[model samples]
Target: MGWITTTWHRLGSPRWFYGMMAPWQTGFGIAALVLLAVGSVWGLVWAPADYQQGDSFRIIYIHVPTVIVAQSAYMTLGAAGLVLLVWRMKMADVAMVAIVPFGMAMTALGLFTGAVWGRPTWGTWWEWTDARLVSTLILLFLYFGLHALRQAIPAAESAARACAVLAIAGLVNIPIIKYSVEWWTTLHQGSTFSMRRINMPAVMYLPLLVNVIGMYCLFGYVMIARMRTEILRRERDTSWVVELVRRPDVR
Candidate 1:
Protein backbone atom coordinates (compact mmCIF):
# COMPACT_ATOMS: atom_id res chain seq x y z
CA MET A 1 0.00 0.00 0.00
CA GLY A 2 2.79 2.37 0.84
CA TRP A 3 4.62 1.56 -2.38
CA ILE A 4 1.43 2.00 -4.39
CA THR A 5 0.78 5.41 -2.85
CA THR A 6 4.35 6.50 -3.47
CA THR A 7 4.18 5.28 -7.08
CA TRP A 8 0.94 7.17 -7.63
CA HIS A 9 2.51 10.35 -6.31
CA ARG A 10 5.56 9.80 -8.48
CA LEU A 11 3.29 9.55 -11.51
CA GLY A 12 2.16 13.07 -10.75
CA SER A 13 5.62 14.30 -11.66
CA PRO A 14 5.53 15.46 -15.27
CA ARG A 15 9.12 14.51 -16.07
CA TRP A 16 8.89 11.02 -14.63
CA PHE A 17 5.51 10.33 -16.22
CA TYR A 18 6.69 11.62 -19.59
CA GLY A 19 9.81 9.49 -19.53
CA MET A 20 7.89 6.39 -18.45
CA MET A 21 5.32 6.80 -21.21
CA ALA A 22 7.95 6.90 -23.94
CA PRO A 23 8.26 3.13 -24.17
CA TRP A 24 4.50 2.63 -23.76
CA GLN A 25 3.78 5.07 -26.54
CA THR A 26 6.17 3.35 -28.91
CA GLY A 27 4.88 -0.13 -28.15
CA PHE A 28 1.21 0.73 -28.31
CA GLY A 29 1.66 2.85 -31.43
CA ILE A 30 3.35 0.08 -33.36
CA ALA A 31 0.85 -2.51 -32.17
CA ALA A 32 -2.07 -0.27 -33.03
CA LEU A 33 -0.81 0.35 -36.55
CA VAL A 34 -0.19 -3.31 -37.26
CA LEU A 35 -3.43 -4.56 -35.69
CA LEU A 36 -5.57 -1.88 -37.32
CA ALA A 37 -4.08 -2.52 -40.73
CA VAL A 38 -4.44 -6.28 -40.47
CA GLY A 39 -7.87 -6.14 -38.93
CA SER A 40 -9.14 -3.68 -41.55
CA VAL A 41 -7.87 -5.78 -44.40
CA TRP A 42 -9.24 -8.97 -42.88
CA GLY A 43 -12.59 -7.41 -42.18
CA LEU A 44 -12.93 -5.92 -45.64
CA VAL A 45 -11.84 -8.96 -47.58
CA TRP A 46 -11.87 -12.15 -45.59
CA ALA A 47 -14.82 -11.73 -43.25
CA PRO A 48 -18.04 -13.28 -44.35
CA ALA A 49 -20.67 -10.89 -45.69
CA ASP A 50 -23.92 -10.31 -43.86
CA TYR A 51 -26.75 -12.46 -45.14
CA GLN A 52 -29.12 -9.53 -45.60
CA GLN A 53 -26.92 -6.43 -45.68
CA GLY A 54 -24.07 -8.09 -47.59
CA ASP A 55 -20.97 -5.95 -48.18
CA SER A 56 -22.52 -2.84 -46.70
CA PHE A 57 -22.41 -4.42 -43.28
CA ARG A 58 -18.64 -4.35 -43.43
CA ILE A 59 -18.91 -0.77 -42.28
CA ILE A 60 -19.70 -2.09 -38.82
CA TYR A 61 -16.03 -2.87 -38.40
CA ILE A 62 -15.35 0.82 -38.31
CA HIS A 63 -18.72 2.10 -37.08
CA VAL A 64 -19.07 0.00 -33.96
CA PRO A 65 -15.46 0.42 -32.92
CA THR A 66 -15.57 4.20 -33.30
CA VAL A 67 -18.80 4.50 -31.31
CA ILE A 68 -17.41 2.23 -28.60
CA VAL A 69 -14.24 4.30 -28.40
CA ALA A 70 -16.20 7.54 -28.32
CA GLN A 71 -18.31 6.44 -25.39
CA SER A 72 -15.30 5.03 -23.56
CA ALA A 73 -13.40 8.25 -24.15
CA TYR A 74 -16.21 10.31 -22.64
CA MET A 75 -16.29 8.01 -19.64
CA THR A 76 -12.56 8.53 -19.29
CA LEU A 77 -13.16 12.28 -19.36
CA GLY A 78 -15.62 11.92 -16.56
CA ALA A 79 -13.13 9.91 -14.56
CA ALA A 80 -10.48 12.55 -15.16
CA GLY A 81 -12.99 15.13 -14.05
CA LEU A 82 -13.45 13.26 -10.79
CA VAL A 83 -9.72 13.10 -10.28
CA LEU A 84 -9.33 16.77 -10.98
CA LEU A 85 -12.12 17.73 -8.64
CA VAL A 86 -11.08 15.53 -5.76
CA TRP A 87 -7.33 15.10 -6.05
CA ARG A 88 -6.58 18.26 -7.99
CA MET A 89 -4.29 16.33 -10.28
CA LYS A 90 -2.98 18.50 -13.05
CA MET A 91 -2.28 15.43 -15.20
CA ALA A 92 -5.96 14.54 -14.95
CA ASP A 93 -6.91 17.89 -16.43
CA VAL A 94 -4.33 17.44 -19.14
CA ALA A 95 -5.79 14.03 -19.91
CA MET A 96 -9.30 15.44 -20.11
CA VAL A 97 -8.33 18.13 -22.61
CA ALA A 98 -6.08 15.82 -24.58
CA ILE A 99 -8.85 13.29 -25.18
CA VAL A 100 -11.60 15.71 -26.22
CA PRO A 101 -10.63 16.07 -29.87
CA PHE A 102 -10.22 12.35 -30.33
CA GLY A 103 -13.56 11.73 -28.67
CA MET A 104 -15.23 14.30 -30.88
CA ALA A 105 -13.65 12.82 -33.99
CA MET A 106 -14.74 9.32 -33.03
CA THR A 107 -18.28 10.46 -32.37
CA ALA A 108 -18.38 12.26 -35.71
CA LEU A 109 -17.06 9.23 -37.53
CA GLY A 110 -19.58 6.96 -35.83
CA LEU A 111 -22.45 9.24 -36.82
CA PHE A 112 -21.21 9.63 -40.37
CA THR A 113 -20.70 5.90 -40.84
CA GLY A 114 -24.05 5.16 -39.25
CA ALA A 115 -25.64 7.51 -41.76
CA VAL A 116 -23.88 5.82 -44.62
CA TRP A 117 -24.98 2.43 -43.35
CA GLY A 118 -28.47 3.77 -42.75
CA ARG A 119 -28.89 5.04 -46.28
CA PRO A 120 -29.41 1.54 -47.59
CA THR A 121 -30.71 -0.15 -44.43
CA TRP A 122 -33.18 2.49 -43.32
CA GLY A 123 -33.54 4.33 -46.66
CA THR A 124 -32.57 7.65 -45.11
CA TRP A 125 -29.37 9.54 -44.41
CA TRP A 126 -30.67 11.09 -41.22
CA GLU A 127 -33.28 10.10 -38.68
CA TRP A 128 -34.06 12.83 -36.20
CA THR A 129 -36.31 10.74 -33.97
CA ASP A 130 -33.92 7.85 -33.47
CA ALA A 131 -32.95 7.83 -29.81
CA ARG A 132 -29.49 6.41 -30.40
CA LEU A 133 -28.77 8.89 -33.16
CA VAL A 134 -30.10 11.93 -31.33
CA SER A 135 -28.45 10.98 -28.06
CA THR A 136 -25.15 10.41 -29.83
CA LEU A 137 -25.36 13.79 -31.50
CA ILE A 138 -25.91 15.26 -28.09
CA LEU A 139 -22.81 13.44 -26.93
CA LEU A 140 -20.86 15.06 -29.73
CA PHE A 141 -22.25 18.42 -28.69
CA LEU A 142 -21.14 17.70 -25.14
CA TYR A 143 -17.62 17.20 -26.40
CA PHE A 144 -17.89 20.44 -28.32
CA GLY A 145 -19.24 22.25 -25.30
CA LEU A 146 -16.39 21.00 -23.12
CA HIS A 147 -13.79 22.09 -25.66
CA ALA A 148 -15.45 25.46 -26.02
CA LEU A 149 -15.58 25.91 -22.26
CA ARG A 150 -11.90 25.17 -21.96
CA GLN A 151 -10.97 27.70 -24.63
CA ALA A 152 -13.36 30.34 -23.32
CA ILE A 153 -11.72 30.42 -19.89
CA PRO A 154 -8.24 31.93 -19.78
CA ALA A 155 -7.10 30.78 -16.35
CA ALA A 156 -5.98 27.14 -16.43
CA GLU A 157 -7.23 26.28 -12.96
CA SER A 158 -10.63 27.85 -13.48
CA ALA A 159 -11.00 26.25 -16.89
CA ALA A 160 -10.06 22.84 -15.55
CA ARG A 161 -12.55 23.09 -12.70
CA ALA A 162 -15.33 24.27 -14.99
CA CYS A 163 -14.69 21.50 -17.49
CA ALA A 164 -14.59 18.99 -14.65
CA VAL A 165 -18.03 20.05 -13.48
CA LEU A 166 -19.43 19.84 -16.97
CA ALA A 167 -17.86 16.47 -17.57
CA ILE A 168 -19.27 14.99 -14.39
CA ALA A 169 -22.72 16.37 -15.21
CA GLY A 170 -22.54 15.14 -18.79
CA LEU A 171 -22.01 11.56 -17.60
CA VAL A 172 -25.77 11.24 -17.36
CA ASN A 173 -25.89 10.78 -21.10
CA ILE A 174 -23.71 7.68 -21.21
CA PRO A 175 -26.26 5.35 -19.67
CA ILE A 176 -29.00 6.96 -21.73
CA ILE A 177 -26.99 6.32 -24.86
CA LYS A 178 -26.31 2.72 -23.88
CA TYR A 179 -29.88 1.86 -23.00
CA SER A 180 -31.62 4.06 -25.55
CA VAL A 181 -32.60 1.21 -27.84
CA GLU A 182 -34.21 -0.74 -25.02
CA TRP A 183 -35.70 2.22 -23.15
CA TRP A 184 -37.56 3.49 -26.18
CA THR A 185 -38.70 2.57 -29.65
CA THR A 186 -35.89 3.06 -32.09
CA LEU A 187 -34.44 1.64 -35.31
CA HIS A 188 -31.09 0.99 -33.69
CA GLN A 189 -30.22 -2.56 -32.63
CA GLY A 190 -29.06 -3.72 -29.23
CA SER A 191 -25.45 -4.50 -28.35
CA THR A 192 -23.53 -6.81 -30.64
CA PHE A 193 -21.38 -8.16 -27.84
CA SER A 194 -23.18 -9.21 -24.70
CA MET A 195 -22.37 -11.25 -21.64
CA ARG A 196 -25.27 -13.62 -22.27
CA ARG A 197 -24.23 -14.60 -25.74
CA ILE A 198 -22.38 -13.44 -28.83
CA ASN A 199 -24.73 -11.87 -31.35
CA MET A 200 -22.36 -12.25 -34.31
CA PRO A 201 -20.57 -15.12 -36.02
CA ALA A 202 -16.95 -16.03 -35.32
CA VAL A 203 -15.56 -14.94 -38.69
CA MET A 204 -17.22 -11.54 -38.58
CA TYR A 205 -16.74 -10.93 -34.89
CA LEU A 206 -13.09 -11.97 -34.76
CA PRO A 207 -12.00 -9.15 -37.02
CA LEU A 208 -14.24 -6.78 -35.14
CA LEU A 209 -12.64 -7.81 -31.86
CA VAL A 210 -9.26 -7.25 -33.43
CA ASN A 211 -10.24 -3.82 -34.63
CA VAL A 212 -11.71 -2.92 -31.27
CA ILE A 213 -8.53 -3.84 -29.45
CA GLY A 214 -6.48 -2.08 -32.10
CA MET A 215 -8.63 1.04 -31.77
CA TYR A 216 -8.12 1.00 -28.01
CA CYS A 217 -4.39 0.73 -28.54
CA LEU A 218 -4.60 3.58 -30.97
CA PHE A 219 -6.52 5.67 -28.47
CA GLY A 220 -3.96 5.00 -25.74
CA TYR A 221 -1.10 5.86 -28.09
CA VAL A 222 -2.73 9.09 -29.20
CA MET A 223 -3.77 10.09 -25.69
CA ILE A 224 -0.28 9.56 -24.30
CA ALA A 225 1.27 11.64 -27.07
CA ARG A 226 -1.30 14.38 -26.56
CA MET A 227 -0.89 14.30 -22.80
CA ARG A 228 2.86 14.61 -23.20
CA THR A 229 2.35 17.68 -25.32
CA GLU A 230 -0.07 19.12 -22.80
CA ILE A 231 2.39 18.47 -19.99
CA LEU A 232 5.17 20.18 -21.91
CA ARG A 233 2.95 23.17 -22.64
CA ARG A 234 1.79 23.46 -19.04
CA GLU A 235 5.22 22.89 -17.59
CA ARG A 236 7.16 25.02 -20.04
CA ASP A 237 8.39 27.40 -17.36
CA THR A 238 9.45 24.70 -14.89
CA SER A 239 13.13 23.91 -14.40
CA TRP A 240 12.70 20.21 -15.25
CA VAL A 241 10.98 21.05 -18.50
CA VAL A 242 13.71 23.53 -19.39
CA GLU A 243 16.40 21.00 -18.67
CA LEU A 244 14.61 18.24 -20.61
CA VAL A 245 14.10 20.51 -23.58
CA ARG A 246 17.78 21.42 -23.59
CA ARG A 247 18.76 17.79 -24.01
CA PRO A 248 19.92 16.89 -27.56
CA ASP A 249 17.49 13.90 -27.77
CA VAL A 250 14.51 15.74 -26.30
CA ARG A 251 12.46 15.59 -29.49
Candidate 2:
Protein backbone atom coordinates (compact mmCIF):
# COMPACT_ATOMS: atom_id res chain seq x y z
CA MET A 1 0.00 0.00 0.00
CA GLY A 2 2.81 2.38 0.85
CA TRP A 3 4.59 1.67 -2.41
CA ILE A 4 1.40 2.10 -4.38
CA THR A 5 0.67 5.39 -2.69
CA THR A 6 4.16 6.65 -3.40
CA THR A 7 3.88 5.64 -7.03
CA TRP A 8 0.64 7.51 -7.39
CA HIS A 9 2.20 10.54 -5.76
CA ARG A 10 5.08 10.45 -8.17
CA LEU A 11 2.65 10.12 -11.08
CA GLY A 12 0.78 13.15 -9.79
CA SER A 13 3.95 15.18 -10.20
CA PRO A 14 4.39 15.91 -13.92
CA ARG A 15 8.17 16.24 -13.83
CA TRP A 16 8.69 13.13 -11.75
CA PHE A 17 6.27 11.15 -13.86
CA TYR A 18 7.87 12.36 -17.09
CA GLY A 19 11.38 11.46 -16.06
CA MET A 20 10.35 8.08 -14.68
CA MET A 21 8.32 7.07 -17.75
CA ALA A 22 10.85 8.24 -20.37
CA PRO A 23 12.94 5.09 -20.32
CA TRP A 24 9.92 2.80 -19.95
CA GLN A 25 8.28 4.52 -22.91
CA THR A 26 11.37 3.96 -25.05
CA GLY A 27 11.36 0.27 -24.15
CA PHE A 28 7.62 0.00 -24.76
CA GLY A 29 8.04 1.58 -28.21
CA ILE A 30 10.62 -0.96 -29.33
CA ALA A 31 8.69 -3.85 -27.82
CA ALA A 32 5.44 -2.65 -29.36
CA LEU A 33 6.99 -2.54 -32.84
CA VAL A 34 8.45 -6.02 -32.47
CA LEU A 35 5.26 -7.54 -31.06
CA LEU A 36 3.02 -5.88 -33.65
CA ALA A 37 5.22 -7.05 -36.53
CA VAL A 38 5.33 -10.61 -35.27
CA GLY A 39 1.64 -10.74 -34.38
CA SER A 40 0.45 -9.31 -37.68
CA VAL A 41 2.64 -11.61 -39.75
CA TRP A 42 1.75 -14.66 -37.69
CA GLY A 43 -1.93 -13.83 -37.70
CA LEU A 44 -2.05 -13.05 -41.39
CA VAL A 45 0.07 -15.88 -42.76
CA TRP A 46 0.93 -18.53 -40.23
CA ALA A 47 -2.26 -19.00 -38.24
CA PRO A 48 -4.35 -21.95 -39.39
CA ALA A 49 -7.54 -21.10 -41.22
CA ASP A 50 -10.74 -21.70 -39.28
CA TYR A 51 -12.55 -24.95 -40.07
CA GLN A 52 -15.95 -23.31 -39.94
CA GLN A 53 -15.30 -19.77 -41.17
CA GLY A 54 -12.02 -20.30 -43.04
CA ASP A 55 -10.19 -17.14 -44.21
CA SER A 56 -13.02 -14.82 -43.22
CA PHE A 57 -12.52 -15.56 -39.53
CA ARG A 58 -9.00 -14.11 -39.74
CA ILE A 59 -10.55 -10.73 -39.04
CA ILE A 60 -10.82 -11.75 -35.39
CA TYR A 61 -7.10 -11.11 -34.99
CA ILE A 62 -7.72 -7.40 -35.48
CA HIS A 63 -11.32 -7.05 -34.40
CA VAL A 64 -11.07 -8.78 -31.04
CA PRO A 65 -8.00 -6.86 -29.95
CA THR A 66 -9.48 -3.53 -30.99
CA VAL A 67 -12.72 -4.26 -29.20
CA ILE A 68 -10.89 -5.32 -26.07
CA VAL A 69 -8.65 -2.29 -26.08
CA ALA A 70 -11.52 0.06 -26.82
CA GLN A 71 -13.38 -1.03 -23.71
CA SER A 72 -10.26 -1.13 -21.57
CA ALA A 73 -9.18 2.31 -22.75
CA TYR A 74 -12.53 3.81 -21.80
CA MET A 75 -12.21 2.25 -18.37
CA THR A 76 -8.74 3.76 -18.10
CA LEU A 77 -10.12 7.13 -19.09
CA GLY A 78 -12.76 6.87 -16.44
CA ALA A 79 -10.22 5.93 -13.78
CA ALA A 80 -8.02 8.83 -14.76
CA GLY A 81 -11.04 11.09 -14.66
CA LEU A 82 -11.78 9.95 -11.14
CA VAL A 83 -8.23 10.76 -10.03
CA LEU A 84 -8.47 14.20 -11.53
CA LEU A 85 -11.89 14.84 -10.09
CA VAL A 86 -11.13 13.66 -6.59
CA TRP A 87 -7.51 14.77 -6.22
CA ARG A 88 -7.42 17.64 -8.69
CA MET A 89 -4.33 16.15 -10.26
CA LYS A 90 -3.14 17.86 -13.42
CA MET A 91 -1.17 14.82 -14.51
CA ALA A 92 -4.38 12.80 -14.52
CA ASP A 93 -5.92 15.36 -16.82
CA VAL A 94 -2.94 15.11 -19.16
CA ALA A 95 -3.30 11.35 -19.16
CA MET A 96 -6.97 11.67 -20.00
CA VAL A 97 -6.11 13.85 -22.99
CA ALA A 98 -3.38 11.46 -24.10
CA ILE A 99 -5.62 8.39 -23.92
CA VAL A 100 -8.79 9.65 -25.61
CA PRO A 101 -7.33 9.61 -29.13
CA PHE A 102 -6.09 6.04 -28.78
CA GLY A 103 -9.47 5.00 -27.39
CA MET A 104 -11.18 6.62 -30.35
CA ALA A 105 -8.81 4.88 -32.74
CA MET A 106 -9.52 1.54 -31.10
CA THR A 107 -13.26 2.16 -31.39
CA ALA A 108 -12.93 2.97 -35.07
CA LEU A 109 -10.76 -0.07 -35.70
CA GLY A 110 -13.23 -2.36 -33.93
CA LEU A 111 -16.15 -1.01 -35.93
CA PHE A 112 -14.37 -1.31 -39.26
CA THR A 113 -13.04 -4.75 -38.50
CA GLY A 114 -16.45 -5.92 -37.30
CA ALA A 115 -18.09 -4.68 -40.48
CA VAL A 116 -15.51 -6.44 -42.61
CA TRP A 117 -15.87 -9.61 -40.59
CA GLY A 118 -19.66 -9.45 -40.78
CA ARG A 119 -19.74 -9.23 -44.56
CA PRO A 120 -18.01 -12.59 -44.82
CA THR A 121 -19.26 -14.36 -41.68
CA TRP A 122 -22.86 -13.23 -41.33
CA GLY A 123 -23.41 -12.33 -45.00
CA THR A 124 -24.42 -8.85 -43.88
CA TRP A 125 -22.34 -5.78 -43.12
CA TRP A 126 -24.40 -4.88 -40.09
CA GLU A 127 -27.15 -6.05 -37.79
CA TRP A 128 -29.09 -3.79 -35.45
CA THR A 129 -30.23 -6.68 -33.28
CA ASP A 130 -26.68 -7.43 -32.13
CA ALA A 131 -26.43 -5.89 -28.68
CA ARG A 132 -22.62 -5.91 -28.56
CA LEU A 133 -22.50 -4.19 -31.92
CA VAL A 134 -25.03 -1.55 -30.94
CA SER A 135 -23.33 -0.88 -27.61
CA THR A 136 -19.97 -0.51 -29.33
CA LEU A 137 -21.54 2.04 -31.65
CA ILE A 138 -22.84 3.90 -28.62
CA LEU A 139 -19.35 3.85 -27.04
CA LEU A 140 -17.95 5.62 -30.08
CA PHE A 141 -20.52 8.36 -29.62
CA LEU A 142 -19.66 8.65 -25.91
CA TYR A 143 -16.00 9.10 -26.79
CA PHE A 144 -16.92 11.78 -29.28
CA GLY A 145 -19.03 13.56 -26.72
CA LEU A 146 -16.26 13.59 -24.12
CA HIS A 147 -13.73 14.81 -26.72
CA ALA A 148 -16.02 17.60 -27.89
CA LEU A 149 -16.81 18.69 -24.35
CA ARG A 150 -13.12 18.94 -23.56
CA GLN A 151 -12.50 21.14 -26.59
CA ALA A 152 -15.42 23.47 -25.97
CA ILE A 153 -14.23 24.49 -22.53
CA PRO A 154 -11.55 27.21 -22.79
CA ALA A 155 -9.74 26.94 -19.47
CA ALA A 156 -7.61 23.88 -18.97
CA GLU A 157 -8.86 23.32 -15.45
CA SER A 158 -12.43 23.81 -16.51
CA ALA A 159 -12.04 21.58 -19.49
CA ALA A 160 -10.43 18.90 -17.38
CA ARG A 161 -13.21 19.03 -14.86
CA ALA A 162 -15.85 18.87 -17.55
CA CYS A 163 -14.12 15.97 -19.25
CA ALA A 164 -13.74 14.15 -15.96
CA VAL A 165 -17.41 14.55 -15.22
CA LEU A 166 -18.35 13.39 -18.67
CA ALA A 167 -16.05 10.41 -18.51
CA ILE A 168 -17.31 9.30 -15.10
CA ALA A 169 -20.85 9.55 -16.31
CA GLY A 170 -20.00 7.66 -19.47
CA LEU A 171 -18.55 4.69 -17.57
CA VAL A 172 -22.02 3.26 -17.03
CA ASN A 173 -22.03 2.35 -20.71
CA ILE A 174 -19.10 -0.09 -20.49
CA PRO A 175 -20.89 -2.80 -18.46
CA ILE A 176 -23.88 -2.43 -20.74
CA ILE A 177 -21.60 -2.98 -23.71
CA LYS A 178 -19.98 -6.01 -22.14
CA TYR A 179 -23.15 -7.70 -20.89
CA SER A 180 -25.49 -6.55 -23.62
CA VAL A 181 -25.67 -9.92 -25.29
CA GLU A 182 -26.35 -11.85 -22.10
CA TRP A 183 -28.72 -9.21 -20.81
CA TRP A 184 -30.90 -9.41 -23.88
CA THR A 185 -31.72 -11.94 -26.55
CA THR A 186 -29.22 -10.81 -29.14
CA LEU A 187 -27.52 -11.96 -32.32
CA HIS A 188 -24.01 -11.56 -30.86
CA GLN A 189 -22.27 -14.50 -29.24
CA GLY A 190 -21.10 -14.77 -25.63
CA SER A 191 -17.53 -14.36 -24.44
CA THR A 192 -15.11 -16.65 -26.23
CA PHE A 193 -12.31 -16.92 -23.64
CA SER A 194 -13.77 -16.71 -20.20
CA MET A 195 -11.62 -16.15 -17.14
CA ARG A 196 -13.02 -19.29 -15.59
CA ARG A 197 -11.90 -21.47 -18.46
CA ILE A 198 -10.69 -21.43 -22.06
CA ASN A 199 -13.20 -23.26 -24.26
CA MET A 200 -11.65 -22.99 -27.74
CA PRO A 201 -9.10 -25.22 -29.40
CA ALA A 202 -5.43 -24.34 -28.92
CA VAL A 203 -5.00 -23.62 -32.62
CA MET A 204 -7.43 -20.71 -32.57
CA TYR A 205 -6.53 -19.50 -29.08
CA LEU A 206 -2.79 -19.12 -29.61
CA PRO A 207 -2.97 -16.53 -32.38
CA LEU A 208 -5.75 -14.67 -30.62
CA LEU A 209 -3.67 -14.38 -27.48
CA VAL A 210 -0.69 -13.15 -29.44
CA ASN A 211 -2.80 -10.54 -31.20
CA VAL A 212 -4.28 -9.35 -27.89
CA ILE A 213 -0.90 -9.01 -26.17
CA GLY A 214 0.55 -7.19 -29.15
CA MET A 215 -2.37 -4.79 -29.31
CA TYR A 216 -2.04 -4.03 -25.60
CA CYS A 217 1.66 -3.29 -25.92
CA LEU A 218 1.05 -1.11 -28.97
CA PHE A 219 -1.64 0.88 -27.20
CA GLY A 220 0.57 1.37 -24.12
CA TYR A 221 3.39 2.63 -26.31
CA VAL A 222 1.06 5.07 -28.06
CA MET A 223 -0.30 6.29 -24.75
CA ILE A 224 3.18 6.90 -23.33
CA ALA A 225 4.26 8.85 -26.42
CA ARG A 226 1.11 10.94 -26.36
CA MET A 227 1.39 11.52 -22.64
CA ARG A 228 4.88 12.88 -23.15
CA THR A 229 3.54 15.21 -25.79
CA GLU A 230 0.72 16.27 -23.49
CA ILE A 231 3.14 16.93 -20.66
CA LEU A 232 5.23 19.11 -22.93
CA ARG A 233 2.19 20.96 -24.22
CA ARG A 234 0.74 21.61 -20.78
CA GLU A 235 4.04 22.57 -19.27
CA ARG A 236 5.25 24.71 -22.13
CA ASP A 237 6.03 27.61 -19.84
CA THR A 238 8.03 25.49 -17.40
CA SER A 239 11.83 25.74 -17.48
CA TRP A 240 12.23 21.98 -17.92
CA VAL A 241 10.09 21.95 -21.06
CA VAL A 242 11.85 25.04 -22.48
CA GLU A 243 15.27 23.49 -21.80
CA LEU A 244 14.19 20.19 -23.35
CA VAL A 245 13.07 21.93 -26.53
CA ARG A 246 16.27 23.96 -26.71
CA ARG A 247 18.55 20.93 -26.29
CA PRO A 248 20.13 19.92 -29.59
CA ASP A 249 19.83 16.22 -28.66
CA VAL A 250 16.11 16.65 -28.02
CA ARG A 251 15.62 17.79 -31.59
lDDT of 2 by residue, 11-94 (tens): 888888778888888887787777767777777898888888898877887788889989999999999999998899888888
TM-score on alpha carbons, each prediction? 0.97, 0.95
Q: What is the lDDT of residue 13 in candidate 1?
A: 81
**Which residue pairs in model 2 clash with each other?**
none
Please write out the lDDT profile of model 1 over residues 94-158, one tens digit for every residue.
89988999999999999999999999888898889999999999999999999999999999899
Model 1 residue 54 CA deviation (Å) reads 0.9
| Model 1 per-residue lDDT at 235 | 89
- Taken over the whole model, the C-alpha lDDT of each candidate is 0.93, 0.86
Roughly what TM-score does model 2 have, to 2 decimal places? 0.95
Q: Clash totals for all models, in order?
A: 0, 0
CA RMSD for every model? Answer: 1.1, 1.3
Residue 36 lDDT (model 2): 69
